[model samples]
Target: MIEVKNIEKSFGGNKILKGISTVFETGKTNLIIGQSGSGKTVLLKSLLGIHTPESGTISFDGRIYSELNPDEKRELRTEIGMVFQGSALFDSMTVAENVGFPLRMFTKDNNKKIQERVDFVLKRVDLTEAHKKLPSEISGGMQKRVAIARAIVNNPKYLFCDEPNSGLDPNTAILIDNLIREITEEYNITTVINTHDMNSVMEIGEKILFLKDGLKAWEGNKEEIFRTDNEAVVAFVYSSNLFKKVREAYLKE
Candidate 1:
């Protein structure tokens, strides 16, 4: 689990995160959702140690991030896995090589052991046959699967996905959402996702944090979104005609 306590961050005197506090539970999909300038990205980056908060604390499990030593912080980073917004796979590397990159960079494991782990993760993501293929040679969905395989190849305890379903057909997007949720549950990883995709929210949003203008406007689960009377959440989530209809149907039931 990850815990946040009254964290504040600013840039060039523009406060981006203002006293944000929340807990992201383990073995569930915790999502941060908001408009383009709502500060979700900054919050995500802070959690990843890319930005330093001026106040408050972020704790993983029981260890506080701000208190960790340099070596300890580096060790903690090794336990994290991140999937970038654009399916950030190396263009020149094959799927297997990309998946094994972490192991080679972080561990003294032999080539055979790394290969075995790479093969296992590739199979887990159902990309066994794509091991030798370059990113350009496969479909976008396949590339996403390869990214996921690489993210998990090191057996990370925390998984962070930034818009994992970006630039895909609706069907493929749903598949990727399901795949992430499944892996989160299967490994009991503390998974956090920063996304604007409402379909992802309805499908796998076990925990939802709604932000507006750098503040947490509301927090709840998928079903609670429909029942919520919070104007900020309602206006943001039901902005589209499709979701408005879906909310109406859900309330009727």
Candidate 2:
């Protein structure tokens, strides 16, 4: 599990996160959602140590990141697996190489071990035959799968996914969300995903953080979103046609 306590972030003079406190539970999909310019992005980066929180404590399991030294920080980083907004795969590398990159860099394992791990992850993501293809050779959804394989190849305890479903059709997006949620539950990893997609929220939002500007306006599960009386959350929920239909269906039932 990941625990974030009293997190505050600022840039020059603009404060971003305003005393945000939340616990991302293990073996569940924890979503951070908000409109554009909300603090969700900053919160994700803050958890990853990409952005330093001025007055917050982020701990993985029990170890606080702010208290770690350089070496310790690097060690902590190794335990984190990230699927970036765009797959972020190297265009030049084949699918196999991209999936195996972490093992090659982080461990002294030989070729046999690396290939075994790589193939295992690829099969786990259902991309066994695509390894020989370059990232550009695959479709957008396939590229995201490759990215997922790479993220899990290292067997990370923490998984961070930033817009994992961006630029894909709704059908493909749902597939990716389910895949992520399944992996999180199966591995019992503390997974944090930052996204604004309402479908994703309804599908796998076991725990959610709703951010507005720089503050956490609401926090709850998918069902709670519709039942809440918070104005900001109400606006966010009803604004999207998809969620409007969802709210209607829930109300009618």
lDDT of 2 by residue, 192-227 (tens): 999988889889999999999988899999888878
CA deviation > 4 Å runs, candidate 1: none
lDDT tens digits, residue span 74-168, model 1: 99999999998988999989989999999999999999999999999998888889888899999998988898988888889999999999898
Candidate 1's C-alpha lDDT? 0.94
- What overall lDDT goes with each candidate model? 0.94, 0.92
On a 0 to 1 TM-score scale, where does candidate 2 land against the true structure? 0.97
TM-score, one value per model: 0.97, 0.97
**Model 1 CA lDDT for position 47:** 98
